[model samples]
Target: MAHEDASFTDISIQAASSHQVWDPFVRLFHWAIAGLFVANAFFTSPKHDLHHWIGYTIAALVGARILWGLIGTRHARFSDFLPSVSGALNQLRDMATGRRHAHIGHSPLGALMIYNLLVTLLVIAGSGWLMTTDAYWGVKWPKDLHEIAVNWAELSVAAHIVAVIVESLRLRVNLARAMITGKKDIRRDSR
Candidate 1:
């Protein structure tokens, strides 16, 4: 009974130290892009007004996110999460040794994933836009490129989901909840 009480107390303490990491705009951007991506990729009919508009919106969101990364809150800034080879290597070492270095912002590998997805989104959007242009309309290569980019983006999103789940479990943090709530309940020991 005493041990359980102590455990609960520790958890409460850990929860109490939680802080807001992802700002409101950051969260909105994250989810909006996610939902919009799904709609355009699967639900929306191709070449229709709705699909075209959604694609444009996604491109706009990506542009907005890039701007935000330049001027947004601490965690949302690219400087906070931009991938570093040394940092990634260190993170890899930590993983191998089972060291829990819970990052307040994006982890090194997470940063790389973000970069990957952003570039992929741009490629997808660019190719899609080209498909509608007068010069490129009915062109086979642009369409092929667009399809390839979509497949790559989908696979990347899947990997992102898997990584989030795995890291959340490994680090004993609710990463998904953190994205939703904008707060990270970082364990004290990880600090």
Candidate 2:
């Protein structure tokens, strides 16, 4: 915050003032996608109607989220979170030493993970949707594509967990709980 970096300074100030970051719709979409993904993974059978329904649910959630990012609350917007590689490295340097970089939205690493999860979810839903169509029925490649995308989604989920843990430890805040409540506990800058 003491430095002259425009992005860092602006985001730091926003973080200092951010009362609530994630909006209700964004939060709803996120948890909805998560729940349906879990249900799809466990309860799915090859030809079962539930699998198709779950896939459609995930797709719809992703579509809504994509729209939300354009007009959502401050931190929920993609413009607020996505960062360049150089900016991320600078943030990483501060993180390495346990410096308090009050990021308003997703951290550099988390921004990447957010993008990753969304992209993966989109691919998963797209391929799964394709598999349900008459042209793709009993097709080897579309099913295979769906599987790969799902695997990537699993990886992204794991990455999300690790990122939450890292940010929690670094910021000394319970981030998972924050995601649910859409609030972060941080001291108001007294400076």
Candidate 3:
């Protein structure tokens, strides 16, 4: 009973020390994109108006995110998390060496993943939209590109989920919860 009480207190202290990371718009944008992606992929019929609207909404969200990346909060800006090959390699090295370095913002590999998903989604949306236009109507390449991009996005989402879970375990940080609550409980000793 005493041990349980001590552990609970420790957890409370850790939670209290959590730093604000994700802003409201970032969180909303993430979940909105995720939900809309799922709805369009699995629920909505391709020929339906709902599907087209969702695609447009996703494209709009991505555009807004790009603008936000230019002029948003500290962690939301593109300058804060530009994808770097060397940085990603270092992160991979850290993983291989079992060195846990928790990043306050998105890690290098995470930044790369973010860029990949953003571009892939944009491609998917663009190709999808082109399919609806008279100029690109009955175009095989756009349809092919849309299908390919969707598959890539799905794979990327799966990888992102796996990476998040692995990273949370490795760093002892609830990253998913951070996205939800806009705070990350990073340990003081970690960099």
Candidate 4:
């Protein structure tokens, strides 16, 4: 009995030390979307052809990501980290209580942020496209919507960055590194 207990603990420790979570497709999609958003937001002017092309590209990438979410690797799938109110509350409780529980994939709040950003980006793309059409040319709502959504997305991105840093410190996991490398190195002592 004692030997069995010790062996089980050893295996648990080893498994918790490190593991692959994000697959290559997920990592690529994440960085691509990030870079494209930065370009469209800062470098490309709306009147330029490059801006329109980047918007189209962002829309296509979002489409691909939706499909991938439906049929992708375990951690990449939507089912792996569905957003939940209870889960978020529980995480908050854990934080308040100083309880350490590191998620191998997206945390509940993280999942919510992911969904929020995806939808916001889609709105920005759709509105931008509408403004280009003959029927909606010179229309104000779509253009207004596009601007509003972009502002929301920018705020969301800032919040996401802060949350990632805070969670990484709390969990003692290098989350930004994990996204880049497709692996998370969780300490064995973490729960």
Best by lDDT: 3
- Rank the candidate models, highest lDDT first: 3, 4, 1, 2
RMSD list, candidates in order: 7.5, 3.2, 8.1, 5.8
Q: In candidate 1, residue 110 scores what lDDT?
A: 86
Backbone clash count, each prediction separately: 0, 0, 0, 0
TM-score of each: 0.88, 0.85, 0.89, 0.90
Among residues 3 or more apart in sequence or in different chains, the pairs in candidate 4 whose N, CA or C atoms overlap within 3 Å are: none
Candidate 3 weakest lDDT stretch, 10 residues: 1-10
Tens-place lDDT digits, model 4, residues 1-191: 11121111112222357879899999999999999999999998998999999999999999999999999988888887776777777677767877667777787778889899999999999999999999999999999999999999999999999988998888777999999999888885545
lDDT (CA) per prediction: 0.81, 0.73, 0.85, 0.83
Task: Tell me the spans in candidate 1 whose CA falls farther than 4 Å from its real position.
Answer: 1-16, 189-191
| lDDT tens readout by residue for model 3, 42-161 | 999999999999999999999999999999998899887877777777678778977766677788889899899999999999999999999999989999999999999999999999
Off by over 4 Å in 2: 1-18, 187-191
For candidate 2, the lDDT comes to: 0.73
Clashing pairs in 1: none
Least well predicted 10-residue stretch by lDDT in candidate 4: 1-10
Superior by TM-score: candidate 1 or candidate 2: 1
